[model samples]
Target: MPDTPTPLIWLAGATGLVGRALLTELGHEQPVLALLRRPDPSLPAQQQQQQQTALVDYAQPASFAALPAPSQVFIALGSTIAQAGSQAAFRAVDFDAVLTVARAARQAGARRCAVVSALGADPRSSVFYNRVKGEAEAALVALGFERLVIARPSLLDGERASLGQPARRGEQWALRLMRPIAGLIPAAWRPIRPERVARAMRLALAQEWAAVQVLESAELQTVGD
Candidate 1:
Protein backbone atom coordinates (compact mmCIF):
# COMPACT_ATOMS: atom_id res chain seq x y z
CA MET A 1 0.00 0.00 0.00
CA PRO A 2 1.15 3.53 -0.76
CA ASP A 3 1.93 5.92 2.06
CA THR A 4 -0.39 8.51 0.64
CA PRO A 5 -4.00 8.09 -0.53
CA THR A 6 -3.43 9.45 -4.02
CA PRO A 7 -2.76 6.76 -6.62
CA LEU A 8 0.55 6.72 -8.44
CA ILE A 9 0.20 7.18 -12.20
CA TRP A 10 2.46 5.25 -14.58
CA LEU A 11 2.80 7.27 -17.76
CA ALA A 12 4.08 5.99 -21.11
CA GLY A 13 4.99 8.11 -24.15
CA ALA A 14 6.14 10.88 -21.86
CA THR A 15 7.74 12.77 -24.74
CA GLY A 16 4.85 12.79 -27.21
CA LEU A 17 2.23 15.52 -27.67
CA VAL A 18 -0.50 13.96 -25.52
CA GLY A 19 2.02 12.74 -23.00
CA ARG A 20 3.46 16.25 -22.60
CA ALA A 21 -0.04 17.60 -21.96
CA LEU A 22 -0.63 14.95 -19.31
CA LEU A 23 2.71 15.77 -17.69
CA THR A 24 1.71 19.42 -17.51
CA GLU A 25 -1.69 18.63 -16.01
CA LEU A 26 -0.38 16.20 -13.42
CA GLY A 27 2.47 18.46 -12.35
CA HIS A 28 3.09 18.08 -8.61
CA GLU A 29 -0.40 16.70 -8.03
CA GLN A 30 0.24 12.97 -7.59
CA PRO A 31 3.20 10.67 -7.79
CA VAL A 32 4.05 9.72 -11.41
CA LEU A 33 6.28 6.97 -12.76
CA ALA A 34 7.15 7.44 -16.41
CA LEU A 35 8.63 4.97 -18.89
CA LEU A 36 10.75 6.37 -21.69
CA ARG A 37 12.54 4.56 -24.50
CA ARG A 38 15.75 6.42 -23.92
CA PRO A 39 15.72 8.00 -20.49
CA ASP A 40 16.35 11.72 -20.50
CA PRO A 41 19.15 12.44 -18.11
CA SER A 42 17.97 15.97 -17.30
CA LEU A 43 14.24 15.13 -17.02
CA PRO A 44 14.89 12.53 -14.33
CA ALA A 45 16.89 15.01 -12.27
CA GLN A 46 14.40 17.85 -12.75
CA GLN A 47 10.78 16.66 -12.33
CA GLN A 48 10.97 13.21 -10.81
CA GLN A 49 13.60 13.53 -8.12
CA GLN A 50 11.53 11.51 -5.67
CA GLN A 51 9.59 9.73 -8.41
CA GLN A 52 10.69 6.82 -10.60
CA THR A 53 11.81 6.83 -14.22
CA ALA A 54 12.44 3.49 -15.90
CA LEU A 55 14.15 3.17 -19.25
CA VAL A 56 12.18 0.70 -21.32
CA ASP A 57 13.07 -1.24 -24.47
CA TYR A 58 9.82 -2.69 -25.83
CA ALA A 59 11.63 -5.50 -27.63
CA GLN A 60 12.80 -7.02 -24.36
CA PRO A 61 10.78 -8.16 -21.36
CA ALA A 62 13.65 -7.40 -18.99
CA SER A 63 13.24 -3.70 -19.70
CA PHE A 64 9.52 -3.84 -19.03
CA ALA A 65 10.09 -5.51 -15.69
CA ALA A 66 11.95 -2.43 -14.48
CA LEU A 67 8.76 -0.42 -14.00
CA PRO A 68 7.77 0.27 -10.42
CA ALA A 69 4.53 -0.95 -8.87
CA PRO A 70 1.78 1.43 -9.86
CA SER A 71 -2.01 1.41 -9.44
CA GLN A 72 -2.85 3.44 -12.55
CA VAL A 73 -1.16 3.50 -15.97
CA PHE A 74 -1.80 5.70 -18.98
CA ILE A 75 -0.65 5.04 -22.56
CA ALA A 76 -0.51 7.65 -25.32
CA LEU A 77 1.92 5.94 -27.66
CA GLY A 78 1.19 6.38 -31.37
CA SER A 79 2.83 7.06 -34.71
CA THR A 80 1.70 8.36 -38.06
CA ILE A 81 1.64 5.83 -40.90
CA ALA A 82 4.07 8.01 -42.78
CA GLN A 83 6.45 8.12 -39.86
CA ALA A 84 6.07 4.37 -39.41
CA GLY A 85 6.83 3.91 -43.15
CA SER A 86 5.35 0.38 -43.16
CA GLN A 87 2.36 -1.56 -41.82
CA ALA A 88 4.48 -3.94 -39.73
CA ALA A 89 6.45 -1.03 -38.23
CA PHE A 90 3.18 0.76 -37.45
CA ARG A 91 1.84 -2.32 -35.63
CA ALA A 92 5.07 -2.71 -33.71
CA VAL A 93 4.84 0.82 -32.29
CA ASP A 94 1.05 1.25 -31.96
CA PHE A 95 0.17 -2.25 -30.82
CA ASP A 96 3.13 -4.27 -29.64
CA ALA A 97 4.75 -1.43 -27.71
CA VAL A 98 1.51 -0.58 -25.93
CA LEU A 99 0.87 -4.20 -24.96
CA THR A 100 4.41 -4.60 -23.78
CA VAL A 101 4.02 -1.71 -21.32
CA ALA A 102 0.51 -2.83 -20.32
CA ARG A 103 1.54 -6.37 -19.52
CA ALA A 104 4.45 -5.11 -17.47
CA ALA A 105 2.23 -2.67 -15.60
CA ARG A 106 -0.27 -5.45 -14.91
CA GLN A 107 2.48 -7.73 -13.65
CA ALA A 108 3.72 -4.88 -11.44
CA GLY A 109 0.24 -4.64 -9.86
CA ALA A 110 -1.25 -1.82 -11.87
CA ARG A 111 -5.01 -1.93 -11.28
CA ARG A 112 -6.16 0.55 -13.92
CA CYS A 113 -4.95 1.35 -17.44
CA ALA A 114 -6.03 4.21 -19.68
CA VAL A 115 -5.35 4.47 -23.42
CA VAL A 116 -5.67 7.27 -25.97
CA SER A 117 -7.00 5.73 -29.18
CA ALA A 118 -8.57 7.22 -32.30
CA LEU A 119 -12.24 7.84 -33.12
CA GLY A 120 -12.90 4.96 -35.55
CA ALA A 121 -10.91 2.30 -33.78
CA ASP A 122 -12.35 -1.11 -34.61
CA PRO A 123 -10.51 -4.36 -35.15
CA ARG A 124 -12.88 -5.29 -37.95
CA SER A 125 -12.18 -2.08 -39.85
CA SER A 126 -10.33 -2.27 -43.16
CA VAL A 127 -8.45 0.94 -42.28
CA PHE A 128 -5.01 0.21 -40.93
CA TYR A 129 -5.01 2.93 -38.28
CA ASN A 130 -8.34 1.91 -36.85
CA ARG A 131 -7.38 -1.75 -36.91
CA VAL A 132 -4.18 -1.09 -34.97
CA LYS A 133 -5.95 1.12 -32.42
CA GLY A 134 -8.70 -1.46 -31.94
CA GLU A 135 -6.20 -4.28 -31.64
CA ALA A 136 -4.21 -2.35 -29.02
CA GLU A 137 -7.38 -1.75 -27.03
CA ALA A 138 -8.28 -5.43 -27.19
CA ALA A 139 -4.80 -6.47 -26.13
CA LEU A 140 -4.86 -4.08 -23.16
CA VAL A 141 -8.19 -5.48 -22.02
CA ALA A 142 -6.71 -8.95 -22.22
CA LEU A 143 -4.05 -7.77 -19.74
CA GLY A 144 -6.85 -7.87 -17.11
CA PHE A 145 -6.77 -4.30 -15.79
CA GLU A 146 -9.61 -3.98 -13.27
CA ARG A 147 -10.49 -0.51 -14.53
CA LEU A 148 -9.82 0.27 -18.17
CA VAL A 149 -10.72 3.57 -19.79
CA ILE A 150 -10.22 4.09 -23.50
CA ALA A 151 -10.34 7.71 -24.64
CA ARG A 152 -11.16 8.20 -28.31
CA PRO A 153 -10.85 11.81 -29.30
CA SER A 154 -10.93 13.33 -32.77
CA LEU A 155 -8.33 15.83 -34.01
CA LEU A 156 -6.72 16.39 -30.65
CA ASP A 157 -6.36 20.16 -30.25
CA GLY A 158 -3.06 20.96 -28.61
CA GLU A 159 -0.66 23.89 -28.76
CA ARG A 160 2.22 22.37 -30.63
CA ALA A 161 4.32 23.44 -33.57
CA SER A 162 3.16 21.43 -36.55
CA LEU A 163 6.24 19.85 -38.09
CA GLY A 164 4.94 19.88 -41.65
CA GLN A 165 2.17 17.42 -40.87
CA PRO A 166 -0.91 17.52 -43.09
CA ALA A 167 -2.97 14.88 -41.30
CA ARG A 168 -5.11 17.24 -39.19
CA ARG A 169 -5.64 20.02 -41.73
CA GLY A 170 -9.01 18.65 -42.84
CA GLU A 171 -10.18 18.14 -39.28
CA GLN A 172 -9.23 21.71 -38.45
CA TRP A 173 -11.07 22.96 -41.52
CA ALA A 174 -14.11 20.86 -40.63
CA LEU A 175 -14.13 22.17 -37.08
CA ARG A 176 -13.92 25.73 -38.33
CA LEU A 177 -16.75 25.14 -40.80
CA MET A 178 -18.88 23.39 -38.18
CA ARG A 179 -18.21 26.03 -35.53
CA PRO A 180 -21.15 28.08 -36.78
CA ILE A 181 -23.39 25.01 -36.47
CA ALA A 182 -21.79 23.40 -33.45
CA GLY A 183 -25.08 21.99 -32.25
CA LEU A 184 -25.39 19.73 -35.29
CA ILE A 185 -22.38 17.40 -35.01
CA PRO A 186 -22.81 14.19 -33.03
CA ALA A 187 -20.90 13.77 -29.73
CA ALA A 188 -18.54 11.05 -30.87
CA TRP A 189 -17.26 13.01 -33.83
CA ARG A 190 -16.55 16.36 -32.22
CA PRO A 191 -13.05 17.80 -32.14
CA ILE A 192 -11.47 17.78 -28.66
CA ARG A 193 -8.54 19.45 -26.98
CA PRO A 194 -5.73 17.24 -25.77
CA GLU A 195 -5.86 18.85 -22.31
CA ARG A 196 -9.47 17.77 -21.89
CA VAL A 197 -8.51 14.22 -22.70
CA ALA A 198 -5.85 14.46 -19.99
CA ARG A 199 -8.46 15.78 -17.55
CA ALA A 200 -10.76 12.85 -18.32
CA MET A 201 -7.89 10.45 -17.77
CA ARG A 202 -7.19 12.07 -14.41
CA LEU A 203 -10.86 11.82 -13.42
CA ALA A 204 -11.04 8.17 -14.48
CA LEU A 205 -7.88 7.49 -12.55
CA ALA A 206 -9.31 9.01 -9.35
CA GLN A 207 -12.63 7.15 -9.57
CA GLU A 208 -13.62 3.54 -10.01
CA TRP A 209 -16.16 2.47 -12.62
CA ALA A 210 -17.57 -1.07 -12.64
CA ALA A 211 -17.79 -1.20 -16.41
CA VAL A 212 -14.97 -0.43 -18.82
CA GLN A 213 -15.35 3.28 -19.59
CA VAL A 214 -15.08 4.06 -23.28
CA LEU A 215 -15.12 7.80 -23.95
CA GLU A 216 -16.15 8.38 -27.51
CA SER A 217 -14.89 11.42 -29.42
CA ALA A 218 -18.09 13.31 -28.58
CA GLU A 219 -17.76 12.66 -24.87
CA LEU A 220 -14.15 13.80 -25.06
CA GLN A 221 -15.31 16.93 -26.82
CA THR A 222 -17.77 17.66 -24.04
CA VAL A 223 -15.10 17.24 -21.42
CA GLY A 224 -12.63 19.23 -23.51
CA ASP A 225 -15.09 21.97 -24.44
Candidate 2:
Protein backbone atom coordinates (compact mmCIF):
# COMPACT_ATOMS: atom_id res chain seq x y z
CA MET A 1 0.00 0.00 0.00
CA PRO A 2 1.14 3.51 -0.69
CA ASP A 3 1.09 6.34 1.84
CA THR A 4 -1.74 8.81 1.36
CA PRO A 5 -0.73 12.18 0.07
CA THR A 6 -1.47 15.17 2.30
CA PRO A 7 -4.51 17.13 1.22
CA LEU A 8 -3.92 20.54 -0.33
CA ILE A 9 -6.13 23.32 1.01
CA TRP A 10 -6.84 26.59 -0.81
CA LEU A 11 -7.85 29.69 1.13
CA ALA A 12 -9.19 32.93 -0.40
CA GLY A 13 -9.28 36.35 1.32
CA ALA A 14 -6.07 35.92 3.31
CA THR A 15 -6.08 39.47 4.70
CA GLY A 16 -9.49 39.98 6.28
CA LEU A 17 -10.01 39.53 10.01
CA VAL A 18 -11.45 36.03 9.78
CA GLY A 19 -9.21 35.29 6.84
CA ARG A 20 -6.09 36.15 8.81
CA ALA A 21 -7.28 34.03 11.70
CA LEU A 22 -7.96 31.16 9.33
CA LEU A 23 -4.44 31.46 7.96
CA THR A 24 -2.95 30.94 11.42
CA GLU A 25 -5.36 28.15 12.32
CA LEU A 26 -5.16 26.23 9.03
CA GLY A 27 -1.45 26.62 8.27
CA HIS A 28 -0.37 24.44 11.18
CA GLU A 29 -2.59 21.56 10.12
CA GLN A 30 -2.29 21.39 6.34
CA PRO A 31 -0.39 22.61 3.32
CA VAL A 32 -2.39 25.78 2.64
CA LEU A 33 -2.36 27.80 -0.58
CA ALA A 34 -3.29 31.32 0.44
CA LEU A 35 -4.84 33.24 -2.44
CA LEU A 36 -4.50 36.99 -2.26
CA ARG A 37 -5.19 39.97 -4.50
CA ARG A 38 -1.98 41.64 -3.32
CA PRO A 39 0.88 41.01 -0.91
CA ASP A 40 0.10 41.92 2.68
CA PRO A 41 2.94 43.61 4.53
CA SER A 42 1.02 43.35 7.77
CA LEU A 43 1.37 39.58 7.77
CA PRO A 44 4.38 38.51 9.82
CA ALA A 45 7.32 37.47 7.69
CA GLN A 46 7.61 34.14 9.44
CA GLN A 47 3.93 33.40 8.93
CA GLN A 48 4.01 34.48 5.31
CA GLN A 49 6.92 32.16 4.65
CA GLN A 50 5.15 29.18 6.18
CA GLN A 51 2.54 28.72 3.48
CA GLN A 52 2.25 28.55 -0.29
CA THR A 53 0.60 31.56 -1.95
CA ALA A 54 -0.69 32.80 -5.27
CA LEU A 55 -1.54 36.37 -6.11
CA VAL A 56 -4.80 36.39 -8.04
CA ASP A 57 -7.32 38.90 -9.27
CA TYR A 58 -10.67 37.30 -8.55
CA ALA A 59 -12.34 39.26 -11.30
CA GLN A 60 -10.09 37.52 -13.82
CA PRO A 61 -11.25 33.96 -14.40
CA ALA A 62 -7.90 33.06 -15.92
CA SER A 63 -6.23 33.70 -12.60
CA PHE A 64 -7.82 30.61 -11.04
CA ALA A 65 -7.17 28.30 -13.98
CA ALA A 66 -3.57 27.65 -13.02
CA LEU A 67 -4.29 26.83 -9.38
CA PRO A 68 -3.07 23.50 -8.06
CA ALA A 69 -5.67 20.86 -7.21
CA PRO A 70 -7.15 21.30 -3.76
CA SER A 71 -9.02 18.83 -1.55
CA GLN A 72 -10.71 21.65 0.37
CA VAL A 73 -11.20 25.42 0.14
CA PHE A 74 -12.03 28.25 2.53
CA ILE A 75 -13.55 31.57 1.49
CA ALA A 76 -13.69 34.58 3.80
CA LEU A 77 -14.14 37.38 1.32
CA GLY A 78 -16.58 40.15 2.28
CA SER A 79 -17.28 43.88 2.14
CA THR A 80 -19.86 46.34 3.35
CA ILE A 81 -21.93 48.40 0.95
CA ALA A 82 -20.47 51.52 2.51
CA GLN A 83 -16.93 50.37 1.81
CA ALA A 84 -17.90 49.22 -1.68
CA GLY A 85 -19.72 52.54 -2.30
CA SER A 86 -22.73 50.85 -3.95
CA GLN A 87 -24.92 47.78 -3.81
CA ALA A 88 -23.61 46.49 -7.11
CA ALA A 89 -20.03 46.88 -6.00
CA PHE A 90 -20.82 45.15 -2.73
CA ARG A 91 -22.38 42.25 -4.62
CA ALA A 92 -19.30 42.02 -6.80
CA VAL A 93 -17.24 40.97 -3.83
CA ASP A 94 -19.77 39.30 -1.51
CA PHE A 95 -21.58 37.34 -4.19
CA ASP A 96 -19.89 37.26 -7.59
CA ALA A 97 -16.30 36.98 -6.41
CA VAL A 98 -17.20 34.39 -3.84
CA LEU A 99 -19.06 32.23 -6.33
CA THR A 100 -16.25 32.62 -8.82
CA VAL A 101 -13.74 31.26 -6.34
CA ALA A 102 -15.99 28.33 -5.42
CA ARG A 103 -16.52 27.45 -9.05
CA ALA A 104 -12.81 27.60 -9.75
CA ALA A 105 -12.01 25.54 -6.68
CA ARG A 106 -14.55 22.94 -7.72
CA GLN A 107 -12.99 22.83 -11.14
CA ALA A 108 -9.59 22.46 -9.47
CA GLY A 109 -10.75 19.25 -7.73
CA ALA A 110 -11.92 20.53 -4.37
CA ARG A 111 -14.76 18.55 -2.73
CA ARG A 112 -15.00 20.25 0.65
CA CYS A 113 -15.58 23.94 1.24
CA ALA A 114 -16.31 26.34 4.07
CA VAL A 115 -17.37 29.96 3.82
CA VAL A 116 -18.02 32.92 6.13
CA SER A 117 -21.52 34.32 5.87
CA ALA A 118 -23.47 36.70 8.08
CA LEU A 119 -26.32 36.25 10.52
CA GLY A 120 -29.91 36.79 9.33
CA ALA A 121 -29.04 35.59 5.87
CA ASP A 122 -32.09 34.86 3.71
CA PRO A 123 -32.36 34.66 0.00
CA ARG A 124 -35.58 36.65 0.04
CA SER A 125 -34.38 39.18 2.57
CA SER A 126 -35.24 42.76 1.76
CA VAL A 127 -31.95 43.78 3.31
CA PHE A 128 -29.27 43.78 0.67
CA TYR A 129 -26.49 42.44 2.83
CA ASN A 130 -28.27 39.38 4.18
CA ARG A 131 -29.86 38.66 0.83
CA VAL A 132 -26.49 38.69 -0.87
CA LYS A 133 -25.08 36.37 1.73
CA GLY A 134 -28.00 34.04 1.30
CA GLU A 135 -27.64 34.12 -2.46
CA ALA A 136 -23.95 33.29 -2.17
CA GLU A 137 -24.73 30.36 0.09
CA ALA A 138 -27.26 29.07 -2.40
CA ALA A 139 -24.77 29.37 -5.20
CA LEU A 140 -22.17 27.37 -3.26
CA VAL A 141 -24.73 24.66 -2.51
CA ALA A 142 -25.31 24.35 -6.21
CA LEU A 143 -21.58 23.70 -6.73
CA GLY A 144 -22.14 20.12 -5.46
CA PHE A 145 -19.31 19.79 -2.94
CA GLU A 146 -19.20 16.64 -0.82
CA ARG A 147 -19.21 18.79 2.29
CA LEU A 148 -20.13 22.45 2.46
CA VAL A 149 -20.02 24.38 5.70
CA ILE A 150 -21.54 27.86 5.87
CA ALA A 151 -20.78 29.78 9.03
CA ARG A 152 -23.26 32.54 9.85
CA PRO A 153 -21.55 34.64 12.45
CA SER A 154 -22.98 37.72 14.12
CA LEU A 155 -21.14 41.06 14.14
CA LEU A 156 -17.49 39.99 14.05
CA ASP A 157 -15.21 41.32 16.74
CA GLY A 158 -11.65 42.09 15.64
CA GLU A 159 -9.06 44.83 15.43
CA ARG A 160 -9.67 46.28 11.97
CA ALA A 161 -7.09 49.04 12.53
CA SER A 162 -4.34 46.49 13.09
CA LEU A 163 -5.14 45.07 9.67
CA GLY A 164 -4.96 48.56 8.11
CA GLN A 165 -8.72 48.57 7.57
CA PRO A 166 -10.84 51.55 8.49
CA ALA A 167 -13.07 51.16 11.52
CA ARG A 168 -16.82 50.60 11.08
CA ARG A 169 -18.51 53.13 13.31
CA GLY A 170 -21.70 51.09 13.61
CA GLU A 171 -19.79 47.99 14.63
CA GLN A 172 -17.80 49.95 17.20
CA TRP A 173 -20.92 51.48 18.66
CA ALA A 174 -22.69 48.14 18.80
CA LEU A 175 -19.73 46.56 20.57
CA ARG A 176 -19.64 49.32 23.14
CA LEU A 177 -23.38 49.18 23.78
CA MET A 178 -23.38 45.41 24.05
CA ARG A 179 -20.24 44.94 26.10
CA PRO A 180 -21.87 46.01 29.31
CA ILE A 181 -24.66 43.45 29.00
CA ALA A 182 -23.16 40.83 26.74
CA GLY A 183 -24.12 38.02 29.05
CA LEU A 184 -27.76 38.96 28.84
CA ILE A 185 -27.86 38.79 25.07
CA PRO A 186 -28.76 35.67 23.19
CA ALA A 187 -25.81 33.67 21.94
CA ALA A 188 -27.15 33.73 18.41
CA TRP A 189 -27.20 37.51 18.35
CA ARG A 190 -24.07 38.21 20.35
CA PRO A 191 -20.97 39.50 18.63
CA ILE A 192 -18.25 36.91 18.15
CA ARG A 193 -14.51 36.98 17.62
CA PRO A 194 -13.12 36.30 14.18
CA GLU A 195 -10.75 33.78 15.76
CA ARG A 196 -13.69 31.74 17.03
CA VAL A 197 -15.34 31.78 13.62
CA ALA A 198 -12.07 30.69 12.03
CA ARG A 199 -11.65 27.87 14.54
CA ALA A 200 -15.17 26.68 13.96
CA MET A 201 -14.64 26.71 10.21
CA ARG A 202 -11.53 24.56 10.63
CA LEU A 203 -13.33 22.12 12.92
CA ALA A 204 -16.31 21.89 10.58
CA LEU A 205 -14.13 21.11 7.59
CA ALA A 206 -12.36 18.35 9.48
CA GLN A 207 -15.58 16.44 10.03
CA GLU A 208 -17.40 14.11 7.68
CA TRP A 209 -20.75 15.29 6.38
CA ALA A 210 -23.21 14.00 3.85
CA ALA A 211 -23.71 17.31 2.08
CA VAL A 212 -24.20 20.76 3.63
CA GLN A 213 -23.88 22.00 7.19
CA VAL A 214 -24.96 25.41 8.42
CA LEU A 215 -23.47 26.80 11.63
CA GLU A 216 -25.40 29.61 13.25
CA SER A 217 -23.91 32.12 15.62
CA ALA A 218 -25.19 30.24 18.68
CA GLU A 219 -23.64 27.01 17.50
CA LEU A 220 -20.38 28.77 16.69
CA GLN A 221 -20.24 30.10 20.22
CA THR A 222 -20.44 26.58 21.62
CA VAL A 223 -18.21 24.74 19.15
CA GLY A 224 -15.87 27.48 17.99
CA ASP A 225 -15.06 28.77 21.45
Top-scoring candidate (lDDT): 2
lDDT (10s digit) by residue, model 1, range 77-193: 888777688989989989989998888888888888888888899998999899989988888887777899998887765543442233545556776786667567676665567
- Candidate 2 residue pairs in backbone clash: none
lDDT of each: 0.76, 0.91
Worst 10 residues of 2 by lDDT: 40-49
What are the models' TM-scores?
Answer: 0.82, 0.96
Which sections of candidate 2 miss by over 4 Å? 1-5
- Model 1, which residues run further than 4 Å from truth? 1-7, 40-52, 162-186
